[model samples]
Target chain A: MSADVLSAYPASQLAIREVGLRDGLQMTARWPSTPKKLEWVDREAAAGVRYFEVGSFLPADKVPRFADVREVIAGVSRHPGAHGIALALNQRGATDALATGVQEITLVISASEAHNAANVRRTQEQSLAEIANVVRLRDEAGSATIINAGIAMAFGCSLSGAVPEDAVLRMIDRCLEAGVDMVGVADTVGYAGPRQVASLCRRIADRLGPLPYVLHLHDTRGTGIANAAAALDAGCRILDASLAGLGGCPFAPGATGNVVIEDLVFLAETMGFSTGIDLGKLVALRDIPAGEMPGEALFGALAKAGPPRAMSWQAARP
Target chain B: MSADVLSAYPASQLAIREVGLRDGLQMTARWPSTPKKLEWVDREAAAGVRYFEVGSFLPADKVPRFADVREVIAGVSRHPGAHGIALALNQRGATDALATGVQEITLVISASEAHNAANVRRTQEQSLAEIANVVRLRDEAGSATIINAGIAMAFGCSLSGAVPEDAVLRMIDRCLEAGVDMVGVADTVGYAGPRQVASLCRRIADRLGPLPYVLHLHDTRGTGIANAAAALDAGCRILDASLAGLGGCPFAPGATGNVVIEDLVFLAETMGFSTGIDLGKLVALRDIPAGEMPGEALFGALAKAGPPRAMSWQAARP
Candidate 1:
């Protein structure tokens, strides 16, 4: 029997970054207190989450939930082996994020022109130009920050309904042309199934040969892990998740924002892949932010269920 | 590029019956009203759920949640092709279910001795003895009530921890010996991942021959859909889903009771297999029973994100 495409996704050591504290909380009705959000990052880092997208630099009024994002980034950045990341919707956001001394800056763009307009009130062409400006700004500042051009709504868009592959390809072409250090793909609304994700990611991976791309998922439709599996099969290096399936796009009606970081980590680890995150601390991390946020809905598998008994179970495997 | 084992699954008429209403809701909070319970079955059946296990015939005091189970079964039995199933925990419950004229009777047993003792305070032999008696009772009653030797916590038991394959096989042997028409497997504590689920189901399927085994999932550790996919790959037909990822086991800490029916339906349909369900209507099922059970949680995907576009942008040759 053939080993198959999915059976060969680098046998774990798969790295998943919790982008929820930044991306998820920013879009919620309630925001966690600065310290609470920091505690979330701290607990996750303690749980073995090596990568973090701490915050984005949009106007505080535009996303008040992320007002203290800067502080959250600074506090979490200090932890050893725990990398801090920030989002850049445009040149200004990129410059501000780079100024934080964070080593990684993720620039997001949309594949659909209609969605790009609806998302940031800019056209896809304008978003592409912003990517160029952000890259130049990071380069001029002498920050060798790993610039990942994240193509948001790459699978399907709520406003536009369905996004085309050529549209995603064009966005990838623009990101490559802008000299991005890396690229990322997202089913921002959780519309991707396993096969659909695999097929589209293979097309994207084929185009952007060898560059590490991030796979961001939303459990809104509960295909988050399935999509992640497909992405892994397509060779995506980094995955984005939240602590407890936090975050949703208010404009997207029913969209859940991103995959729960802890759950995805368990899936990778127990499936014979190694994610360096500590499961015990990750489960505990749910409490720190939940207490402060109050009404914020936190969703995750491992947070509610403790870590997988891989050690004991593997030992018992006859 | 050869076809994977997923091809063997019945793609056209995949009727997933949610036994959670009977099996899952039974163990939850104080029993809801008869109308409230019927509302769930009505909504789910209307949402393209062809089969629904509305309630069980266990003693009222022991499992008050299913007290008015007779009303629920009678109401849902009216829906065309909606096979109203009821769980019979013992011969007495089975006799009561037979009186209701339910087409399907699910006779459940815990695969592990520890779990069996904990669940019904009985030994495995005692449970099997009851199953054989119920099968005889069904035959004498002159009803075509098929028995499903539903094994709960088949993957891993909370008390026993890791349920052995031999234990599962022993139960299957008992089920067949007792003349069960079909067999089913449950991951009651949310412990089974797809790889493990696939490996186990293949062995179980080998013993059961062509009798379809349903994969009952709990999203406790976030491997529900992946396990469903694995089961599909292993040629299992029926799947169990709750309306909206509602109801987790209180005893199982992190277990999200069952896979969301809408999400499972969405996953199967979008993967190019026909599940004979209309995705759009499935989301509307939640509305009918909303006020009846105010605090009850429901989980689903298509309810969040709409269906995928028939057209994709991958630029593949038509």
Candidate 2:
């Protein structure tokens, strides 16, 4: 059957970016050692995961787990076609990330003022200015690293509550005007349903007109993958997911985890969009994180239920 | 916002059928006492849930939890606008269910031969014959109860693997020819993705030309609510969900639970379809199941994360 026969989106291929090392580690108290993190990257790359958010360039005191960001990037760089990404909150962070020779740097600013302040201790305008400076620094340094501005709480916010669609679009516009390579809309608190996701993402897509947007979703209220599906329906291509559904929004009380990368691959591939990631290998790597944080709860239904019997389960593995 | 503005389906009013008391209990070892089951029904009824699958009429030895099916029905009958549904495997089961004066009796027959045999110890044709017999008996007794044929494993089967669309369509046709009032498609193994659910449901709807289909989903692989959303997009109004996402398929190994009723309501209402079920009350009732089944896992994202701040949380209460 033709791919578009069932697809609501225009794209024939879907891109899934791994965020377990960066986003997952940030939420957990325990951190995988640099070697373990590199091993995780290598295993995932073997499973055909080309893109990864290796770690963040935050202060070592603020996020000690990601202090080895350079090592992580160097490890991922060994694999051909493996694009290592890092998160940068300010000009200093961006400069540090660029020095590591990372292919991409994600700059985040929450659409909800309360969430932005709570998360970054800065006003939205201040964050926007920092993003512009980071872009300029990258241009001056002649870095080829792509800048992806992640609009956090674009759907809704835990601290500030309902984020207006106009506010989110305005944020996207500001980020675009700052000369970022790409932009991502994140449901930081997992407050979005499929309709809200589809409507808002479609609106942004319409405004951007060919400029692709990524969906960074959390399953806080358990609408993560469904919202991702709706985002695809709204023309989203790149999806941010964590292995074994790791990570949680510290601001959103009772928020559990990010959308399970394994499940998201299942959803995308099963819906006729090729994700190019091996489900078996990704699901198997759940053990790596679980081993590091012994008592921590890891989640993903595919790891437990196995693949659907209708498909060639054995053939899906490497 | 008008319901149809965002809805892909034509229905403005959505029907949520609570199956926690029956389907949820079937695979569970702990049975809430008859009184507890009655209380559960009462609480849900008060929460504006109009339909419920109260019990199944299997042998007491096979399903001892539902031995007091009559008592459960009697308890639900007191609430006005409340419709009590029961499942029956054969003529004997249907006759027993009919004596209890249930508003609806669902006859289950898996679309897959292997599953049908394993589930009911009968071939597909034999089960179909029994359903016909049950329908004839209801007609002869002049019972006003609607007969719903629930085609299990309609999406895909763990036992028999990929069930062809034509096989499912033929089964639906046979059930329709058997004089059943309505038919429901069940993802017995949680093997369905949104695309398959939407495509097949749409095909069935197109062929039937207005026959309302119910979606019986399992969260085994964590696609339950997403599949529920797809079913709605395909014009399905009746959704079978368990409170606290209770229940699992005894036959399907490691299948976790049905779609969470609380999350489904959240999804439906958030998507502009008015389910008329109070989310606050239903969420509170999760405690009853959790209390009765100690150490047993109860699943739902809304119960953990609380309601989305976008909605008027206080106003959702009865």
Candidate 3:
């Protein structure tokens, strides 16, 4: 791990990008309505969550949950400091997303060819070409939307096991060459442990220099928060999580959900790092999803057992 | 983290002491029969788990699951390399446990006074005095069984939250003064995170010098494996885990179970440390518990998703 890169991070701050609206809602059979989603954004932004993956730009017929991406983006615009991000797979989605005046767009490509084919029905190379086209489209449109290239299945794939580190590095190079502002590595199927997460993050940080790399982890194997801690120790700062751990792999049904953002906030706060999230308020919002989608399994430890009473979030951070 | 202590650990070795028979069965309403427990011991021993906490020397009326502790000890004696350990809270239990010819006896005392009283109806001072009495009895009886003082709620307590670090260290000093061969720390109510676990373990290691320290973690907050990883990184080697993540806190109902031995084994193995336990064998034994208690919640991701295909225990270790 490079001390320089680590030092570059705010000594007391960590950024948590909430993906519950995008990654979480897509897996649900029944999801929050557009009005409910907008309410969620408003409540979350008011609760001090700065980054929200509000929705994904995709075919409405395929994913009805994200059909109101434009409305959701418009709702997010009311908040001054809240940065709303949306996902786009190609030029069409990017063009549509830009029209909504969203600030950031994430272009995703799977490191595993099989996963890419299964997820988007395109090869890794084809997905990269499409991502490049999206980047060109964003640049040509003179949109200030930041393009963050997300390398899904960066660790290993459910369909194709043992994605080589070299393959992930090569994809990073391609994403960088194609004009991505930042790169994010994801364990799409959550097949990683702490050691693997730490080793890969360190290698990526060493190679990427100062370019920000995010770790998007799933808690499938129950090692997500552990892996996140390992990634932080290895100097990879940005992380992606969902509220109440509300996501699952549509392909692998019973796998665990994404790392719970509430627990992640507790972890960061407990570790003495400042995440501006109000733990009490963030945990309280879990009831919205739970009430709306009854019988949906919500996961998090901090919610079950309150944070340690010794450390007051306000006093410790301030 | 002390690099020297971590490097000093036998490069390829880690010790996992299975506490399922004592901890898991105690919480279970309907547990395996005496013969079934002996079979579990034998099978686990055959599968390369060397240390087994077979039972506790508590009254049969209180915990019917451990009524056959003597028989279990005799059964474990048949396995040449497998070491059998049992819990003893007082001199009477210690004497009885020694009479059973067990290889080791663990004397437990809670770091919090409230928890100590709630658990055993004794104060910390009373428990410490009883432990001292047990040490004297063991030495007077010419017993060779190893004595380990397990400090429960060393991190925090459910009955009494915020167990000060000073209190834990004071208890450790008292336990050492009481003539125990080794000392173990436990998150009896599972209120600890990785940072706390690491800091406590590092402090314990620094204070104890050459004395061995063990970490007994519960998965109540889903940070169990992460805590285990942090302990390993902090130079603590011995760990206690229950098979299939069984065992709940009788005090704090609805709290999560113990750290699953199978998942801990996976974490250790993935981090390049060798725990001779067989993943397939450990996972298969989960069925024994699940079958006996039909509605029991058996947890572990490895059992559901299987180990990563790239790393073979046979090839990686051998």
**Predicted complex 3: CAPRI docking category:** acceptable
Off by over 4 Å in 1: A1-12, A59-73, A206-210, A233-235, A253-255, A307-311, B1-11, B60-64, B140-142, B206-209, B253-255, B278-282, B287-289, B299-318
DockQ-best of 1 and 3 = 1
Clashing pairs in 2: none
- Tens digit per residue, CA lDDT, model 2, B1-318: 011111222255677889998988876769788878889989999999988898889898867898898898988899987788899878889999888878889999889898888888999889888888888888888887888899998877787677777888899999988778778889887878787888888888898775577889988887887888888877888789999878876655555788989888888876777777877888899878888898777877778777775574212211
True contacts kept of each: 0.42, 0.45, 0.30
Model 2 misplacement above 4 A = A1-12, A312-318, B1-12, B310-318
lDDT score of residue A296 within candidate 1: 74
TM-score of every candidate relative to the true structure: 0.87, 0.93, 0.90
lDDT (10s digit) by residue, model 2, range A72-153: 9999899987888899988899999988878888999998888889889999889989988888888888877888899998
Q: C-alpha displacement of A230 in model 3, angstroms?
A: 0.6
The candidate maximizing TM-score is 2
Residues forming the 10-long window of minimal summed lDDT in candidate 2 chain B: B1-10
Model 3, A1-318: lDDT tens digits are 011223323334577988999998877867887878888888889888877898889999987889999898888889986677899877888999988878788888988888889888998888878877877887787777777889998878777777777788889999888777778999887777788888888889889886677799988767788888888878777899999888976555665688989888877765657787888888889878987878787877667665555554223111
Q: Tell me the DockQ of each model, to 2 decimals.
A: 0.39, 0.36, 0.33
